[model samples]
Target chain A: MTGTAYVKKIRSGEARLWPSRRPPLTRLDIELTERCNNDCIHCSVNRPAGDREARAREWGAESWKKLLDEAAALGCLVVRLTGGEPLLRDDFGEIYIHARRLGLRVMIFTNAALMTPGLARLLKDMPPLEAVEVSVYGMKEHTYEAVTRTPGSFDAFRRGLGLLREHGVPFIVKGAVLPATRGEMDEFEAWAAGLPGAAGLPSYALLFDLRSRRDGRKNALISSLRTDADEFVRVSRRHGEEAVGEWRDFCARSGGGRGGRLFSCLPSGGSAAVDPYGRLQYCLGLRHPATVYDLAAGSLREAVTEFLPAVRDMRSAGPAYLERCGRCFLKGLCEQCPAKSWAEHGTLDTPVEYFCGIAHAQAVAAGLLEPGEKAWAVTDEAARTKRRR
Target chain B: MSDKIDLDRIYAPSEDIVVREIEGEIVIVPLVSGIGDMEDELFTLNETGRDIWNKIDGSRTVAAVIRELAEEYEAPAGLLEGDVAGLLEELLVRKMVVEKE
Candidate 1:
């Protein structure tokens, strides 16, 4: 009742309800592997070396195909293949081909270390060669390798990207700005722009709090190295001009509220995340049972339509749970959605303070909020205004 | 399958969401969240299906609706029934409405 009223009050300024008014999902994100050559400090799926077999038992290509088919049947137009490294799988080419043949645009997210001339040629031969995005950790060998924690990974990725370019395959570069790579943002952006097919030279920043693998010991290394709120704002403000004009425009228009960059409307439940093991999830970072759904043996559409209402109901009743986040103005800017809640607090709504701080910092950098504005004040005013109106 | 629907039972999405033609595909969005990122999995009704979906307001009986549709669209009633039935089944399954039967 409170959430319903809360949503109604906040959405009153607008002419219609949120989320329920948006289109349902037409995209699927496939995590091809948890195995990674590099043990990054902020990775969520960086399984221990000894747990390789156990992790492998979780999901595979066959399961992936079934999920992809279900997504396609539901009118999914694109599938972004990701993970520790999707290229580690020998059958990556086959899977890409299969999805493309089904009329779905397929994208790959990888470090590109394992990418070879052969794989490049295979992708170039395919007609639906959607852009390949590679994650560059840092500018130099020492800094980049330090973040990835893998020796020689930088050289491998560089060569791999070159192979893709020489073969005339479309690709772009994205970078994670850990403390090690923070200073190299400009260099990485310039290098990415110079790459073939990278006319726009787009890049991304990995929010510190979004490290799903926070439980891992190695993540601690990068966790401490993560960009702090005040400093993060300073860096963004300093380098904001480097972002492409369109991206900046998009960020400005849709960073929050009705016209922001949110993938789905909050609280109204327009979309959800289906995990690697076929469990329906409210967010990718959450591991709780309540937000999980079994999709192993049923119609995908039926499962979503039937089970989603319950999940939405539970999330709607989360004020008793998500106290800190429920009142935060940075809910839109922060990546602390239901999945992130599960990862950090093992609940659907609990707030991870780190994300809250990061969002405020980013907002200040983007000039969405004053530099000294307290997050609580903003949330309180918004809440008070909603109650009064 | 009944071709007519009861408009009273069908709940239309609120006015803030616009369902429009985008290059051939129907693009539906909250009046607030414009065309979303293509990567976010926003689904839309295809053109042909969108045409049929607009008619299912749940006001007409299955038989009467089909007869009207047959004459208006100049298609055979039998052929229209199969497509209409399939579409209705999908719409019903989405919790867009409940069937009387």
Candidate 2:
């Protein structure tokens, strides 16, 4: 009976061996809304802030709290409050305080454009449970407002930071280099370093991928902001050998043998996310309804027990998946996932060539793969899958 | 946790906190009441603080840690005592360290 027990490996210590079972769900990421005060060209998930028709179907505050209750009962310990801007919600305080009271540690992801004095005070008065991730677009107003496309957003951000400072609440400032903010790279890094919590926080984004939602007609804007595959990998190369070494270590303990499942990752087993309209999906970037468990119609328990098992047990089904993504041995390094695939092409199985190019470039640069080796091919696994098919 | 923690109180690190040594600094993450942040969820201890945190093995008293650090660094015992007391006070309030047997 114990011939082959599934093992869960943690960092720096012993790996816990478990019998094959449902993945333990510990964190819940609730996208409070898809609305944002900013209209950044690189954004993948924002609708216009005042688009009333778009928000008509969104769940109200009560529904959100009820979902939080359900999530808490599901053994979720931390609830990440994120969005186009989580601060855009008027009832954010009520929802945040409720989560805290329910014993859920709340982590807020915000743009700082709407962080008011009252909000900062409320957060500071409470015990420092987690970090507030404030997105910093540009150090200067002209550049910043260009990215946000809002006239007074920079002032709001400055005011928000001021409020946090006045109350002595520490936050981490992070940024992504879009076309509009690229020239301010040095200015951004220097400013981020000057922050109180800058020493141990993420301060930049590397390899910004294509729009996760594809945003239909709005894809043009995101693509315009996105650099080419070569440029993306060039930025990623800065991490150098550390990234390669980390990937090597990850694969060894990940339970993925030469021909293991493409996504034999703990994330699919251990975590789940809920989008704005009460649909429970596997991750923040995935919006596949067929794969989602509807929280509005069912309990989290049912979702975990029934829906997640099916999701976890999901196998590659098509010829394309078997050829490229399923058989790829760059398991740790590749960014190809169902979420990325779905976001790029509306299919779970198709490999996004752009991601492949980036992965191959990294592999070549890091000496993991030969410079001319096929980016989308794992020779041995490809042959194995071909025979099996 | 009183504003004045007794000098002789034996304290130990909380089981709820996860301490990891990353890139030289010791990072303490409160995992019991909250989820650790991917970017900034940890409270890192400086070299001195890490040494103190490591010596808190539930068997040692506050004064013991102070004496050990003072001797180890050849610093004044009186100064070390003040620093340790201040740090312990903050940690106690945050519930990262608690009085033990």
Candidate 3:
């Protein structure tokens, strides 16, 4: 079928061929709270200025428990707790324990300023606590604070990282690649690699994209932070093939550090994401009306094998949807999913140019595209290496 | 490297197999037709392998599976135990099964 038709069918009601047989080993991600302390330039989930009180009024502890139990029974081995900042929720620790007791490994993606010694100790005692991912906005206070727009955040984040280290909790640090921080890229990677458990860990930079923020506005800081493609390629090359390989994989899947497409993304039917309100979605990027479900009422297995797949087929299986995304060789490499789709087309399948630019930049650096070629060139040397058997 | 298996590093089936239990066997079908297609590829375990697997399931002590295998096989108990242990280690390395306390 044509890409547009394909996505439509999947979105409409086509069952995902794979997940229908067995429950997923992974639950799509669940957004713990929309309450984030940092007004990051690229935050799609950050509550809009007028809606802060409304959002907080909507979610609470009881809602979290109902969703957690269902996710556990669905056989999700990992649950990534995210938010405006998950730690902002007073009940985050309780939710973590609930999921852990159900045998699910917990990974917290946070800005790190909220980490405390006591929390570190508490986490240290929990074996299911896998890794805490901290996002470093920049290498220095001015640069970091410019992105976070919060003075002294860098210090708080540093102290938080230190607490986790002293307590022996496993944590990894990542950074955003923006105009303000681009010059400090190497220094940032050096800092990430120096963390306690960072050996063999490759620090990655998420490109500053307009789609992530859900607004067409591009931050001037982002413009200046854009790294030259050749420079990134040269720097990544010096770090050895392994480091570059990790970045390459990160691009292919979730730019957020979760195992991306290689594991199971939208098309693969291996994951299901539930929002803070218990609405089910295909991926973190694409939130839709029909695709969403109330976790309080139905069987997760039924949702996965039936309802979820039909939504995927109907929404994303069509050529109109596929014309922008499905055919791109960079499809796997691009982070432009339904969330991005909403940002650009107000729908789940349309492509956004900001992601196109980021992918193009990486494609060029990795030598997957000709110097001036706009379309993705998947047969290039870099593509060949990335697809290594 | 001693016969003592570290649970984190090893994933072994819980039990041992015999000729009678060999009724069904599972194999991983590697799909290497081209690159960029690596995903979980596991097959079913036959009855014999299942018996051996049950013994090695991590809950039972090593001697129990050995005793069970020995009784079922009617073979020399000592040699069979060694063979079963070796086979379990192989499974551990392959990640076909896991070890727990």
RMSD of each: 12.7, 10.7, 11.6
The reply for model 3, stretches above 4 Å from the true place, is A1-22, A48-59, A209-264, A267-269, A297-299, A315-329, A360-389, B1-101
Top model by DockQ, which number? 3
Instruction: Specify the poorest-scoring 10-residue window by lDDT in model 2 chain B.
Output: B33-42
Candidate structures ordered by lDDT, highest first: 2, 1, 3
* Model 2 global lDDT (CA atoms, 0 to 1): 0.68
Q: If you assessed candidate 1 against the hidden native complex, which CAPRI class would it receive? A: incorrect
TM-score of each: 0.66, 0.72, 0.66
Residue-by-residue lDDT tens digits, candidate 3, A1-389: 00111101111122342334444435547677776777666555665323567465555777766666766556454578886688877787788777665545577888888887767877776533356788888888998888877777889888888888887777778767666776897787677777776766456565443333344454443444555555555656665676455545654553221212222245533677767666666666555565677666775667777887676556455454455454456555666666655655666666666666666666666545666775432334344445642
Task: Tell me the fnat of candidate 1.
Answer: 0.00
Q: Model 1 over residues A158-254: C-alpha lDDT tens digits?
A: 8988888887777778778777887787888888777775676465665644445346455465467666777765655555554223223433443
Q: Could you say which candidate leads in TM-score?
A: 2
Residue B23 of model 3: what lDDT? 16
DockQ of candidate 2 compared with the true complex: 0.04
**Worst 10 contiguous positions by lDDT, candidate 2 chain A:** A1-10
| Model 2: per-residue Cα lDDT over A220-274, one tens digit each | 6665666566676655545455655554454333322223243454453366788
Q: Candidate 1 or 2, higher TM-score?
A: 2
Better of 2 and 3 by DockQ: 3
